[model samples]
Target: MPHVNTTIIIGAGIAGVHAAESLRNEGYQGQIMLMDRDSQMPYDRPPLSKEWMKEESDNANILLRNPAIYEKLDIDLKLGVEVTGIDSQRKTLDTKDGSSYEWEKIILATGTSLRTLALVGDDLRGIFYLRKMDDAVAIRDHMQHVKQAVIIGAGFIGAELASTLSEMGIDVTIVERSSYPMENIVGRQASAYFLDLHKRHGVQVITEDAVTQFHGEGKVEEAITAEGRRIPCQAVMIGVGVIPNTEVSVSQLEIDQGYVVNAYGETSVSDIYAAGDCTSWPYQGASIHIEHWDHAVNHAKTVAKNIIHPQSAPYTYTPYFWSDQYHVRFQYFGHAKEWSKTVLRGSAETDAFTIFYLDAQDIVQAAFLANQPKHALPARRLIQQQKPIDTQALADVNIALKKVPRLQGESNTSV
Candidate 1:
């Protein structure tokens, strides 16, 4: 292990905080400094889109860890300190508050920034974006005064927001650019199912159209679509996407839309590491980037372990994601870009279904479970094995999914 006088972590979100905690768990006694631009305590971001918007909560409610835990862990937490630049050679960083600090090692978990619309009426009132706690606080406060909401995108954030607003008795009209939103993640059929689900819940979904401009004097009174459809609403939430917050210039630090890293979470620069949404790490022999709560927690922990034992600790992460929409829980286990076949285990109308993605060899690459808690954990564990499963047993609801997977070099029969 390298002798470290101090370790400074940028971005005090889940990734940065977890990295600091995991460092202590890995038996590190060196000085650990956790810093972020936001002044508030580190909080869970996933809840902000759903529960935080639906319920009444304060800053303390969304905190990732107890306030006193940092004192016990001996972590130095610095808030509202915006890191402007990084000197990879000097092992130091500069903050917006005109303070400079040097460290033996550094980790960048800067996360992401919300992508906003740059149209003519973007600066109008009642237009918002949800990425941080402050944003959620503002949106929640505004939701009380608003009767109708027009969501510009139909991604996870958009869908979750629609569900939350609907539960709050706010009329929601979703304007999606893609006819089948999130088809890549949930598949085409499930995408259609989601559209129908929202419609059945009294959500007016306007697909194959986009908000071109807002029409109002000072406040946004109406949203004009590209197809000339005008939507009147009290509020508009934009959830197009997010851009990686990796602006610091580090010499030879490779960045392909994000800070590129290996399974070890080590960047091209030595004594410097990165994780979370701001990184593109290796997975399944290829490099990919994931932006989700589970990925941040798992990736940061793996990175923290490798920081102590750089070579021994490898991140064998099975990407996992889940969303709570209305009364149903949606979960997707593992990652898969392409698959030869898909097996459906349950009916979609019943709202308890699992769609398994398999390659040419019939090995499960990924599985999407909708309101199927019994199959989620087991599917997550078995997908990592990359073994073929009995199709007949997998499709049968009566058969246990745990017994459907065949061992290595076994016949095409369930174990």
Candidate 2:
């Protein structure tokens, strides 16, 4: 084993913090430093859009690890510290506080920043974007005084936030440019289910429209649509998307959709690696970037292991993500750009359904489960195998999912 004198991990989010813990568990006695700009201890992000957005929930339970764990692991956790630049040649980093740190190995897990709207009055006080815990805190504080909200996007974050606000008895009007909510990711039919879910809960959804301007004296009072229609709302939440935080890269690392990395999380430069949402890694035959809680945890484990065991197997796992809205729990596994056919299992009307997207060869490319969470794992395995599936049997709910046979392999165990 190569001797690692000291390791530095940038970004104290889930990925960076987990990397430090994994390194210690792998028997590395070297020094580990986890740094982040946020002063708060590392906390789970998923809750920020849901429970933490509510008035009752606090940060008490969202912490990823207790302070005692970091002390016991002897990990140097420096919060509220901003890393200014990285000198790849010197293998050292400079902080904004005029301090330089040297490391034998470095992991760049700097995540992402929210993409803001370029419309007029974007800097208005009540218009907000949720990305960090502090952002959520601000939104929660603002949400208390507002009776209605205008959400600018219909992505996962937008949908989840709409649901949270609706549960708080605030009227939500979701403005989406897409024809249907989550249309780009889950397809039209599945998106309709989410749209219907929101409408049933008394949330108004405006499709094929966008908010182009905010009008108010100081705080936002109304959102003007591109069609010239003015929607009155006290609060506005923008969930357009997120951009990778590559400022630290400074042309030092290759970047595409994000920081380019190999399957083992190795960047173009040696002794440097990147994981989490900031990384774009090679998958099957494509370079894919994933921004999900599970991906962060899994990628950190892979990168940490590869750092310890360079000759280990490459990182390979099916992508999985879930969203909770109202009473529906939506789960999806795998990724697909274009699928030839979509096979439906169960009844969509009853809200218990699973859709399997298949390619031209009838191989499972992706699967979306709504309210039927039990089939999530089985759907992931089908994608991993990439074997042709029985379309007829897949549509028949009477036939067990595990009993569905593959074109070349035996029947998978029934879930």
Candidate 3:
């Protein structure tokens, strides 16, 4: 670590800043230059669609850390600097500002690029995407004069925006291309819960439909769906999805869905590493790219730890993320793309429940909790342990999550 002269971190979002802070905490004496293309100070992103959009945040309280803290940590915070190229062999970086810097190590925390629409109204004035702080600010300002809004997609961002805009008394309509949006994340049984939540909030959700055309003069006035539906809207926000932002000029750097990295966040090129959403690291013997706040924070810390002392720690934490829509908040723990079946605890009807995604062997792969605070810790622990679960006991509200692994019975359990 003493030989390490400088550590250049790209992208100053949650991952980059935390990586800098974690480097200091891990006793890395090297010069840490944190850079981002964004001019704004580092801010949390989850609130951008929910809290920041719903209310007026004067760019003060939205900060991820206080302004003084960056100075205190001696992290050279470069807000508007964008790295254009990376010379891995020479260990130097070229920036868009015509600046070149020599670095012993580099960490890529570039995050993801927000997915945008390519329809006829793509150039419309009122069309927007929510990814950065400034995007939310613009949307918030325009919302004052907007009477109707059409949100495309039913993912976390789109759904959250629909809820916030609808609560503000603006007519909100969501056009999702999938018959059941978010089915891949929450499964079909729980997917119905989300639709009902939006419907109850008076959000006109049009499923299995995609916006094909945008009709307007200079600004957007109406959206034409693939299903021959015409909807009038003053503003449009798209939340389709995002792809990894891997734009480094290095040709040899391995990339599969994201910048390929090891468990210790070491990239293919020596002295170069990557973390957060831009990295695909080995997890449970499979390479996976996770784009979530919790993953970014924890992965950055682990990368920092390894940079300070190589192979000292590995990122093995269970994946987790949360979404806030309307008055309800949903917290999901672990990751399960496919499961044998979803074991439900409590009732989705009662607005509180936990869905466990178990494999064929009845092992806990992941769990979804809707306003279930008591089960959060236990569910996380169970998922981490990867122990065989008793479906009946797990689903039974009487049996605690921690105890479900211990007591396995064939008896049918009811909420």
In candidate 2, list every pair of residues with a backbone clash: none
For model 1, the local distance difference test gives 0.87
TM-score per candidate: 0.95, 0.96, 0.96
In the order shown, what is each candidate's alpha-carbon RMSD? 2.7, 2.8, 3.5
Worst 10 residues of 1 by lDDT: 406-415
- Segments of candidate 2 deviating more than 4 angstroms: 1-4, 250-252, 409-415
lDDT of 2 at 398: 84
Segments of candidate 3 deviating more than 4 angstroms? 1-4, 407-415
lDDT of each: 0.87, 0.87, 0.87
Tens-digit lDDT track of model 2 for 333-391: 98877788899899889989999998877888889999997797788888888788889
Clash-forming residue pairs, model 1: none
Best by lDDT: 2
